[model samples]
Target: MHLLAFNGSPRLRGNTWTLLNQLKRGAEEAGATTEEVILNKQHIKPCQACESCKKTLVCRIKDDMAPLYGSILSADMIVIGTPVYFWSMSAQMKAFVDRWYALDLDPIRPRLAGKRFGLVVCYADSATETASGVVYAFKSAAAYFDMRFYEPLLVTAGDRNDAAGNPQALQAAFALGQEIAKP
Candidate 1:
């Protein structure tokens, strides 16, 4: 199986990326092909509600997102990793999610149906409430694509690099990856 993980954190080596790396390691060990896309480094534009995708089943915007559509559709599983910002996803992550509207338009509805989906989130606050909103956001997006949602793995950290060298979060991320890769 192939898995594509999208890192929505702007920080290159931030908590979110660290956890996602652990997940990728586990998937690789499981003999599954895995790839990571750093959204912040890509030139993806937010949907403009142009309704072009409804007609052509493709977005009209000539940007990085055009290439991602094939990868998203071809993946057996997809993992989205983001850092919580003010009890919600970061703006960079939100922009990536908004582009999914192209895949939701007519003739492209359920483009990712039946694919497995996983969520990984990092929050500055230790309280679960701080992660609740982001979790809902992932759930809603998964539902829209008719994807099967897997249990989300969340890590609470007091510092930006809290995920680094953290064995527990790393283990959880690896386990989540294994589960997603399993039949």
Candidate 2:
């Protein structure tokens, strides 16, 4: 099995990254080949809404995102990790999500169809509900694409790298990864 994780936090060592790393470890232990894409290090341009890819199956703007398209398409499982900002996902993850429009050129047929989807979110607020929008976005997309959307792991009260110190959060991430590895 091949699992691909996308870390959408700007900070490489932030809470979001910590959770994703733990998850990756678990997936690897389960015999899945796991890879992580750090969005901050990649030059992924925002979707221009030009709709060119709707017919060509390619993006007009050529950059680091070009390679990720193949990764996203080939992965058996996809995990999206992000930090909650203003009751939603960070700008980086949102931009990445927007670029997925390129894969949805056909309303009935999506490139990521039938893949397993998971989400990991870190938030400062005690109410993890603040990340509901991010959850909804993934859930909606998964449903539209006939993908399997797993229950998300939300780590609340995570500031900076606080999640690294939270044993429960780390365990949850690991467990989620194992679940994703199952056939």
Candidate 3:
């Protein structure tokens, strides 16, 4: 199986990234090949909302997001990791997610119908408000695209590497990875 992970946090070494790595290790152990895309570092522009793509059957923007369509189609599962900023996901994550609108219209969308998607969210707050919006949005998007949604792994971490010390969080991430990778 092929699993593609997107690190949606701008901080490369933060808790979001930490959990993603742990999750990736579990998937690797389960015999899945994986690839990671650091969304913050990619030059993906926000969706223009132009109707042209609907006719063209592809995103017309000639930016970094051009090649990701193939990656999404090739992967059996897709994992997105992000830090809760304000009451929702980071801007980088939002931008990447927004660009997925065209994927909904792609001619190859049917071939990717069952692509599994999971979210890994790290937040500083104990309250649900910190990450619930992100959870709902990703879930809703998966539904719209007909992708199977895995249980999200939400970690309440206040520090950069808190996920490393939180055994429960790490274990959940690892299990999530394995769950998606296994037949």
The backbone clash count of each candidate, in order, is 0, 0, 0
Best candidate according to TM-score:
3
Candidate 2 has its poorest 10 consecutive residues by lDDT at 103-112
Selected candidate, larger lDDT, 2 vs 3: 3
Clashing pairs in 2: none
- Candidate 3 at 183: error in angstroms? 2.0
Q: Which of candidates 1 and 2 reaches a greater lDDT?
A: 1
lDDT of each: 0.88, 0.87, 0.88
Candidate 3 lDDT for residue 59: 87
The TM-score, computed over Cα atoms with residue i paired to residue i, of candidate 1 is 0.95
Lowest summed lDDT window (length 10), candidate 3: 103-112
lDDT of 3 by residue, 94-138 (tens): 888898878777576686678889899999898766789999999
Q: Model 2 over residues 1-183: C-alpha lDDT tens digits?
A: 999999999997889889999998888888899999999888888999998887786789898888888888889999999988887888888888888888776742566778999899888888867889889888898898789999999998566769988999999999999999876
Where does the lowest 10-residue lDDT sum fall in candidate 1? 102-111
**Between candidates 2 and 3, which one is better according to TM-score?**
3
Given candidate 3, what's the lDDT at residue 58?
A: 82
